[model samples]
Target chain A: MRNLIWIGFWGLFVLHQDFWYWNDATLCFGFLPIGLAWHVGFSLACSLFWMAAMKFAWPEEIEAWAAESTER
Target chain B: MEYLSFYIVVGYLALLIVLGLVSKFYSRGTSADFFVVSRTVGPVLLLLSVFGTTMTGFALVGSTGKAYTSGIGVYGLMASWAGLMHSVVFFIVGIRLWAIGKKYGYLTQCEFFRERFASPALAYLLFVILVLLVIPYLLVGVISAGKFLQGATIGMFPDLFGLPPLVLPDGTERQHPLHGSIPPEWGGLLICLVVLFYVFVGGLRGAVWANAFQTVVFMVCGVLAFYLISQRLGGFARATEMVAISPFASNRLVREGNMTQLYFLSYGLIPLSVGMFPHLFQHWLTARSAKSFRLTVIGHPVFVMIVWLPCILIGVWGAAYLGPLATGQNPNMILGRMVKELVDSQILSGLVTAGVLAAIMSSLDSQFVCLGTMFTSDIVLRLSRRTYSDEQKIMLGRIFIVAVVAVTYGLSLLLKDVALVFDLGIWCFSGFAGLFPIVFAALYWRRTTKAGAIAATLAVAVSWSILFYRDMLSDKPPGSDELTLFGVLPVTAIFLLSVLAIVVVSLITSPPSANTLRKFFPDERLSRR
Candidate 1:
């Protein structure tokens, strides 16, 4: 399940890069350019994805290691 | 207003010096305390210091100028990729390194490589390559500080210490907006001296505290500068409207001309350079615990957004408002010019100027301290093969730090109207990125050998030198030409060569001993099978 989540997040993340969509000059909401707007939204999504990764995919041993170090 | 801004910048420098002195109290008079802050930095300070060091002047002054010339694509090419990838590196490379560092009492990257490969000669080779890669990066910081100071204090000096105006080839005295604005040479020298003083006194702990404070100053002032500039351009909507109808509108949406798809995609590799940065390695070792990196990994993207979004927008907006800059004018001065034109209050502009300097100096202090640590730990002490007192180690580091600052400052003075800040910085990042494969493999792959690591390092050095020389010879600007090999960036070529050298050489050579492998990755071997 954790592997699936990482795959899904990275999949969407890489796809949204929008290199192929660079030709679109249409303005979004009548002001922001579509390319720039796409990235703005994507950046926000990345923040959530990264937070999720921290919650689920973080290495358990690292947590244990940190706990051990502090006790010393 | 100009004088006020100069005074504010001076005051900011004084504040940083005080912060440096305060950190001295925390020093335990040990090399470890001086180099890695006794390994006791909390999450918040670590997050701020790491983020602050990564941003540099390129995020502010360079990005604005890049946006003016290239368009909004600058954000996608650099920032967005960095936002996601930098965090990924922190999670993968940073935490693991911290775990290993703490367990082994390691203080520098060379020490880790030496132990992992069990080869002292390899450590010496890596040290030379790493220092060579770092000096150009240090030069970038110094050059940008000089440029920013000169631009912010324009017209504040009329006579330039009573020196006459420069005469043009036509025998006419040249006229500038302010007669005696500080030149890049003098401005760069002043910044070097100030940074040297703090790093001399405070060490890594001083750099961390200063980074946290400077991070706040730059972020708050950056946001304010963004808001004020947009408001002066008749609000965000009006500014967008202006850019939408301008001749450069196409540049805003699509990367028009020279920004090819392959080239754009290759920039994704650039942020991976963080894994190999000596300064970042130093910062990673300073973490109080492995868990301290959690905040930095999660929060880095948001910080990148906050800082980069404004600079990119301001640059895009400059297209319509400022129009085309004159020939031979420094595009790096665009951000400074926009602030002067938009802000009416002297105190506000003064604060903003200090904010820009804050961003530049935050990175400068860390680089200075990191180099000092590397020389003392990796070269001097390692080669001498004798134990030294804590005072001797600290004094040796300080002497090397002073030497580095003097050399970099002297180089900055010799440079006249060099490449744009973004262009010079990208080349430096490319060299480090090319070396990333070696470090990544050493940490993850048990088969990686000392021979392979040496081969990869040499490949990066040779390819970087050849590509850099080629770039210098061409009439095209460093990054302006749409040059690609097999439809990928020069960095991609260099990175591939490095990987090949490492993989093939390690296969032909004897693998690392089982004991060495167990020590580095005791639990991971079973999982790999």
Candidate 2:
């Protein structure tokens, strides 16, 4: 899961380029331009991916070190 | 009624001062408390403070102006990339830096670098570079505030404040009925004084509390401004359709001409500047725990989208509503002009203008506080012979904040005529982004030598200076035929040069001492994991 989360992060970076939609002027859902709408979805995906990364991939050791230092 | 918006903005400033005074009562009166709030900030305040500080006038005023000229493609060029990348930086760089800062009692990035590389030279070098980069960043806020105020309050005090027609630097005569009404210089000065007052008294705690509050105000006001403008121009769909169908602006609806793929890809590097921002570094150190970053990391992209989407749309709609702007017309004022012309209610317009001020001032306070922290903790305390009490340290910080605010305001005045808020902002971020390679290497690579870091720093500084000088000489209009390296922004080239310098120099020079490695990269095998 941690590895996959990392992969998703890199994937999103590449996907954000959105070369295909660059010239498209078609409005998505009657308002948003296609390129703009694609990114809106991309931003939402990034939010969810980050949430998952925090839950599954966070390095617990650093938190433990910080807490122990505070205790001292 | 003419001064209603200005009065509401004044009311908001008063509220911030009250909040500052209130925060002083809660402050612990220690240097630690004043600088980082003793690292007691929780998740919610942390989220808002970080977001507020990051979303400066650049996000609101500069962005709208850019979108007006460049079209909806502007969103893809920056907003979406920023949404995904800013959180990435926060997670990857911010968390580790916070843990190290808390453990070693680091109050500023200079302090951390000084200790990590065992080189005060690097720290001093970094201090100069960071301050230079930050001044223009500070100017972005000042310029935006001035332009917004001047643009919004036009015709309000025409008789009292209007000036005789004077030729601008661009050789255009003052065209508006209220040419000098609430001049940009006065607006910028007023914001500087208000922000300095709160940051001086309240310290980091005051700044954070105010940031959270201002974040709410600006977001609400932003949405209201968006909705009201859209309604006035027919609904959102209709406004966009109008822009799409208009012969003068139909090109704005699509990605063509100057919105090249290479140009868009280069913007991805710009958001990395946040990783190296001194203000952001200070904010990270104030987190209660690593868990505290969870909310900020997850919520930042969403917050960015919320603020940016509306501002971009408004700018796109401006192309149709405003028609062809005069060649010398400032785009920074487009959003302000839109609100003034479209939003009919004086009360609503006042609140919306105040909201724009809220976004601009939120960043000013944070940057002010961070500069003070760097001066007091990183430079003065480190170099002083005599020890000082917490109160004295706080006193020195407050004094320096005043000095920085004064210097920034003076610079803003000199550059007010020529600076495009968005262009100036991109240049500032480019300088910082070029330095990102050093920060990343410092945190992750145990073998990174002091010489290598210095070499990389010099690469960024030299490349950025030359590029900025060339861009200025070109004197081309924004987003059209400015200096580029291989058709992408000079930032991409500068970043690559820094990376190359770091790698080659680190391989050639001896690595950092084992003690230093143990300290910064403890559990080296598991560092990446």
Candidate 3:
């Protein structure tokens, strides 16, 4: 799941830039929208993705750890 | 040189001092207050402050020097692109770091990383590397400001003090001195006074509030300087032609240039360490919402567009005029010389110089504040598990701040080879690039064990220590080819190798106890964070 989110983040980064400075890379393979709206939306997706990752990675870990420590 | 702009400089200086002192009352008040502005930095001001901090006078001076030599290579332009693109990561990873920091009440990136990775050892390692590498970046800005000061107040202060004549680059082969000779320390002292004034008072919060104003001052002044110099030297088209015709014997366009690739790619790696920076983590923590973090990044590209245009030209102009003159001088000083030569008035030169100082000092405070907090709070106090009164913690932090500045100041004076800094920085980040994956996993992947985090982090740290500065490990100075390899291959290899190592190790390792996950990612903590 972390890998998936990481992939998504890097993928978005690759798509956003106009790094086609060279003629060989001039293929206009547009992936996302242009301008501020696109920027805002893309960031939202990333934010959500990270939030979900945190929760998934440490599911109940906080509470469970707290309880165990208290018992000890 | 006209003396009218001296008023602008004086007014701006007064404003900077007033702004710093006033912010003491208004900026955040606690440890968290000092570090993260209570996570309540607003948009307009936050935008300005962040931009001001990101690009410094080095952008003004050194980049101009590169442009002066390289002509109008796109490398100069890439600063904005890199800066703007940095936001995309901020929008993505930034919110995660912020939310986590808020949840844990973490003051520094080290604390967050320690919690997330369940590896306090690795966190300490990171803190040290961050402080060390970031010092060079800070000093780059300081040195640039110093150069600007030495040039700007040449005539006016002579009568007032022991100032001397400047070797005007007026087709003269002679070297001259300014009012008394202003060295790097004196200029550094001025920069330190202004930056320390605000940062000590308001901390990051004050810096945040003041940066917005400084950002405007830096940018408008930078663009104005670029424009005046470009026109004085000849228009942009002719400037390009001069670059095309001159000794820029390389066939690469700025976009296609060899260094360009390194710069753009190196910039992309900036985000790799962004989640790990103490200052940025502070900003992330204070965020009202993940939305703020996202907005910071999304809004970044626009700032890139606005700031990069004028800045790239300064470099271009400097490259054209001073390419031959950059014998022993720092490439970054190209713009400073151009400014000194092109401007007619002492006042305008002084105002522009003040703006340059503002740019450099702005970059310095964030690092000073962030690193100081990390050293004092996370490493010293947290490691000792000593609960300090607020005043004590603040005092510890202040001492660390002075300590960091003093050491970095000494380095700026003693150490000349700055490229070593970028090398060390990349090396340090690469040491922990392995943790970046784990950080992502902690945010998302539930199966990630602390053991797995430890395994990959150690593997990469060891690997980076060897690979990142492998050339420096040798007896001989690195050849261009070897430097090029280090520039691209080794760092890239470490980044990739670390990710791979983490995945393999995590699969082999015992799963993190469910309890660990629960405490690390408690559902009830949603609104709390």
Q: Which predicted model would earn the best DockQ?
A: 2
- In the range B21-140, model 1's lDDT, one tens digit per residue, is 888877787888889999999899999999999988778888888888888788888888898789888988899888888877888999999999998988988888888888878888
True contacts kept of each: 0.44, 0.69, 0.04
Better of 2 and 3 by DockQ: 2
Kindly report which residue pairs in candidate 2 clash with one another: none
In the range B445-508, model 2's lDDT, one tens digit per residue, is: 8888899999999999999988888886556776765677887999999999999999999999
Please give the distance, in angstroms, between residue B215's alpha carbon in candidate 3 and its true position after superposition.
Answer: 1.4
**Native-interface RMSD of candidate 2:** 2.0
Which 10 consecutive residues of model 1 chain B have the lowest summed lDDT?
Answer: B520-529
What's the lDDT of the predicted structure labeled candidate 2? 0.87
Instruction: Report per-candidate DockQ.
Output: 0.46, 0.65, 0.09
Question: What TM-score number comes out for model 1?
Answer: 0.94
Query: lDDT score, residue B111, model 1?
Result: 95
Instruction: Rank by lDDT, highest first.
Output: 2, 1, 3
Cα-based RMSD of the predictions, in order?
A: 2.8, 3.0, 6.7
- Model 3 whole-model lDDT (C-alpha atoms): 0.60
